[model samples]
Target: MSTPFSPRLIKGGLVLVDPDTAQVQRVIALQYNAESLRRELKGQESGEAGTDRAEPTRFKGVALETISFEADLDATDQLEFPDQHASAVAHGLAPQIALLESLSQPSSAQLRKVNSQASSGMLEIAPMLAPLLLLVWGAGRVIPVKLASFSVTEQAFDPALNPIHAKASFGLRVLTVDDLGFASKGGALFMSHLQNREQLAAKAQPVSLATLGVTGI
Candidate 1:
């Protein structure tokens, strides 16, 4: 008997990269792929309405894009082997939840530095910059984004009241050259994403004007 072929599964993840060298710092892969992803795009109009007839079709730059999705995390499988997965048996999914939450939060090191400066009587501390965050859907799409919103609901818990199953929802605003500038690593990644979109668009089949009951404009 011949064995049936099984397809390989690709998981989506979030990647944190250094802004200067583009080195990947951390990768958080979704335990299970989100069933659906929601995306919204808003065009940047060049001028006010009725300012000029041609201005209606003009655009200032790339459209603002946002993506949202919900992922589920569960520790049931790991809980079967308590000795091997001690952390999962102890804290349930708290560590995993904390990892995602930390994306939007300033690091402890940065907070300590700020506190030190204040205690030393220093004024006008500079703002701390976070590492570039990238949403990786697949090989075709990897774009920089800012965490707009994040919410998690604990569905199931262990005996100690630690959450074992949870659902995490995230809203991400796609960062572009306008936000990051061309010199930054994030800006470069955004450009690559844009270019990939253009390539995909080029592969799309075109229809004739006659199909829409039009001979000529």
Candidate 2:
């Protein structure tokens, strides 16, 4: 073969058979002797092929997965490939790497849930505000307000009156001003998205129409 086969990289170790209990253990990276192992494996494959059967690649064992939460964990770090398998750590020790991975997935789900809730709340409440503000502003403009009262003596307007005995009634009211854009924007966006979805759905369902040179697009 003119092209070279890529070197097989092993993060987990070789499989070792225990004679006493008939159990297999993963030996993880005792060391990375990639070139040496490559040469040997290639030689074995080439020699074994003379028998007319497909040569099996070396190193088929359980995988040892690692986590890289920190910036440092990469290809350069060399940890010993254990001579023993998980039979030792299977009982007591929990790897921190796997624990971190477990939390990562749930954390992402939590953030997504929080974002959806915030969006829902914004959409639910936004429409009520705009109309309310508009109503308040309209009310303020239309209704005359005078919470404090002042009385002028009849002498000030007594051109043709006997003590100016006409009674006047005044009413005061409070109202909220409506801010249309602040309140209605969220609802408008939601409705717009819904309409867009309807449009997309209408376009998607197949129908017989004039062929425009785009058959199965």
> Model 2: residues >4 Å from true position, as ranges?
1-183, 208-217
Global CA lDDT of candidate 1, please?
0.95
Write down the TM-score of every candidate. Answer: 0.93, 0.14
Q: Which residue pairs clash within candidate 2?
A: 13-28, 28-81, 29-81, 133-177, 133-178, 134-178, 136-176
Model 1 C-alpha lDDT per residue in residues 1-217, reported as the tens digit of each score: 4356766779999999999889999999999999999999998878766675446677889999999999999999999999999999989999999999999899999999999999999988999889999999999999999999999999999999999999999999999999999999999999999999999999999999999999999
Candidate number with greatest TM-score: 1
The ten-residue window of minimal lDDT in model 1 covers 48-57
Q: Residue-pair clashes per candidate, as listed?
A: 0, 7
Stretches of candidate 1 exceeding 4 Å from the true structure: 1-4, 48-54
Question: Tens-digit lDDT track for model 2 on 1-217?
Answer: 3346866443422222232342443232322222221101112232243475543665332122111111111211111222353321232112322322232133555667667877877544221111110001111122111122212222211233223222211121212112112234323332443355468788886855445556564
Clashing residue pairs, backbone N/CA/C < 3 A, model 1: none
